[model samples]
Target: MLQTMIMTIVAIPLVLGMAAALGRSRLPAPAFALLLPLFAAVVSIGIEGMPAFPPVRAAHKFPYVLAAGGFVFALVAWRMRVVAPALAAIGAAIAIGLPAWWMGANILAGNSVKATTVAILAVLAIVGAFVAAARKAETPDGAHLLPQAIFATSLASALVAITGGYMGMAMFNGGLAALAGGYLLVSYVSHIRGNAQALALGGVGAFAFAWVAFMGLVATALLAPKASMAGLIAVGLTLPAAPLAAIVANRLTHFPAALRPLINGLIAAVPALAGILIAGLQFAG
Candidate 1:
């Protein structure tokens, strides 16, 4: 168990931090970020040995989504010098929505109400993620909101997934949260302080990684034998926390400029912590 934590939690963030630093360097930025999500995916595999070759379980299929999603978004990032809203929206929908369908289709098949409800919520999540990533504050202080959002969401999801009846996915989400934190820390130096392109976190590749991985975790968790929809929904409240943070932070005009990002991060964490608590209560009940 300790070994698993070292590999899945500790080592992953260290590797991701290095990767984010290198990706932000002068050497063809987008290429270095192409496999960023795969870093977390490998740790996930470490938590639970490689899925069957044929992948008989719906959850096993997530590896392919992570790989394909990261690569596709990397290409999009490589080509898109600027994140065109329409194109980002389309990419996010395909990357996030398609994977959700792939994992949840069978799981949600028996209940039309669940299927429709999840479908609508999934759409909202995709749109919210896109808008959050696209939003810009007058200062670079807001540059980290998307990463903060991703980190908070993944952390809350990890706690919720365990109680929601998916320990493997929970471990995987824990690794994911680590990766986001690493990305944020390293990219802060490269992008925020140095004023480089957001190749590591805020860019198209990073946002794609964040949304794809988080949604994939949720979709795959839904396939768990005893998955709880309420827990999943509770953790999902963190999905919109980033933009909400922005809105809330804007209302407080007196904070120091340098402290804005941290303040926004704390705001996002509120919903995340609340989600975890709500999910925990649901699980206990």
Candidate 2:
């Protein structure tokens, strides 16, 4: 477990930092929103090793889903100047639904209705998250607020997975949270340093992979028999927490600009913490 924490959470500085550095220098667009975290996620998955191709098991398909999400989101953002959340949701439905059906073929054959319902809910949840994340810089109080919210989402997801009896899923979410935290760290520093890159990542500029990966992760987990679906939904409340926090913080007028991101994250953590506690209670017996 310590090793898992090290690889997933602690490695953020080294893994994600290096990825961000590369994006700044080598990449033409220099956007870390999708590629950087995706890179971190892929590296973190190394803890479990590479997932098998043409995954026969539904659980084996996360890596592929993450990659596809990364590509689809990146492409959509690049091609279209602006994308409606509904359109993105539909695209997500296709991108994620196909794989859910494809990889869970054998297991979900008889549970088609269940799988479809879960897929719908997953898409809805993803849209909610996208819409919320879209408001990242709406107030300009917290540039890192978006990624910090993402960290909360993933960390809360890890808690849900833990109570659901899915250790692998827990670690996966933990890694994602860690990677997002890395982004948050860098964003904080850049914001303080007054770098151009600070505001670049401010909105959903490079969030192609996160939404895609989110749909895949939630839908896949919800489909699992042992999954704590209710708990996960409760955890989903964290989706809007960041933006809402930002709004409230924005109203404060005197709130320190430099501390805005941290404030938003701390506020969002409330719901996530509540979700964790609720999930823990569910398994208390």
Candidate 3:
């Protein structure tokens, strides 16, 4: 776990630095966003001594599945533009649902019915989030969606660590948050230099949403049976909070444009706080 943490911390900066360099080199925004998180996931798995590809058990196979699915969804969003979220929902449903079904069959054979129910709920949640994110991505000032998604996922991931005692997963989430935050910083630099229009691309929003939803589903699956259902739902709620908050924030016509991000950040933090409270209760019990 300590090794995982160290590797994640190191890899985030390295990947972000490379991403920033690439951004400065006039790389397209969609490619930049898609590649960075994918690279981070690969680096994370490598550092954890996990195989990139293996005919392994479903429990051990989800990270790779999510990574690939996220990339494909991101690409679809980049190319299709109009129906990106719908496409992403289909991909995410398959990627997340298949592994969940496998886990249901193999690990929770005694509770296969309940497992199937959970898998269905998970797919629904992910598809819902994708739709919400897709709607937000269509707005003119949707750049803030990416960072908000990243931050919310980071918080939920940390909560999962608290609930499940999975330090490696926590570190992986931290690395993704760091990468997303760093990318925003780099994008700001690009915007300042007049190289780009906004801090994020619509395609990146899809990628970020997919990544968060995938991780949330994975965390819930791993932790829910052991933890309180309320706590698990609290954590799951964080996945869509950011995009939803962004929608509200965008509608705040009274607020200054420059202060919108800060307001959105606060709104996003609400679900995180709720998650932390639930986690603390679970730990205390």
Candidate 4:
């Protein structure tokens, strides 16, 4: 009951924050969007009333670590050109080391081996994301990655929600899902500036459809034990399928000239097909 209420309260801010961030050209938009998730996290902490975070297990609250890792990577990347190779090397090392330390800590604290592994991988992803961002920031078009970053972070939050639900961290999953969905919508829409408002509106509409469909599946998993079966179906069918369809459609419509059919075909085919196949198996069974 509390979880549902909290999710309801958090949803409004999450959606609005995402919309605002997506519309803005400056960094503050994303900054503000970022806060919505943090706010959710804070609310979750209060709800759970867990005394002190358990020794941070992997596949758990690792996104927090990833956020921090990205920060550290960006800091190191700022000095990349000066010590080019060395900076890259150090960044790579820390990327590897942070997970190692995280896992070691989890193990020492008696976390499950699987959880420890997931935690490390999450940290690595966050670090890699940062390192990429840092390296790109040095280039003339580094700003382009912002959209991708928003996308990546949104995806990460979705994954967090799924994993958190599996771990019985119900509030965490709901809050994270709400926040991630909101931000992605805002960032993606905002990136489509100076275009026809109609087209932008259409794009947002499509994204909202996808977002709602996906989160509905996730929400079910968190909120209902029996609904896990339905959640599985939705995830397998909608999650990858929706995104793949949207990406392909966008490319065909707006980026027809820029679209590399063969390349994009392969890019879209692999995952979309895999997602369908996996879903088919689940349905079959």
Which candidate ranks first by lDDT, i.e. highest?
1
TM-score of 3: 0.74
Over the stretch 86-189, how does candidate 1's per-residue lDDT look in tens digits?
Answer: 66666656766677677667767776655754665576566765675566532343445666777787887778777767677777777778777776666655
TM-score of each: 0.82, 0.79, 0.74, 0.44
What ranges in model 1 sit over 4 Å off?
27-29, 111-117, 133-139, 187-201, 225-228, 250-260
Which has the better lDDT: candidate 1, or candidate 3? 1
Angstrom error of the Cα, residue 179, model 2: value is 0.5
Q: In model 2, which range of ten residues has the least summed lDDT? A: 196-205
Candidate 2 stretches with Cα past 4 Å from truth are 1-5, 12-14, 21-37, 105-120, 129-137, 195-206, 216-220, 223-225, 240-242
CA displacement after TM-score superposition, residue 78 of candidate 1 (Å): 2.5
Better of 1 and 4 by TM-score: 1
Best-to-worst lDDT order: 1, 2, 3, 4
lDDT of 2 at 195: 60
Among all windows of 10 consecutive residues in model 4, the one with the lowest summed lDDT is: 198-207
Q: Mark the regions of model 3 whose C-alpha exceeds 4 Å error after superposition.
A: 1-4, 10-14, 17-25, 28-30, 33-37, 52-60, 74-79, 84-88, 102-105, 108-130, 133-137, 141-143, 188-197, 216-220, 223-228, 251-258
In model 3, how large is the Cα lDDT of residue 179? 59
What is the C-alpha RMSD, rounded to one decimal, of candidate 1? 3.3
lDDT of 3 at 120: 48
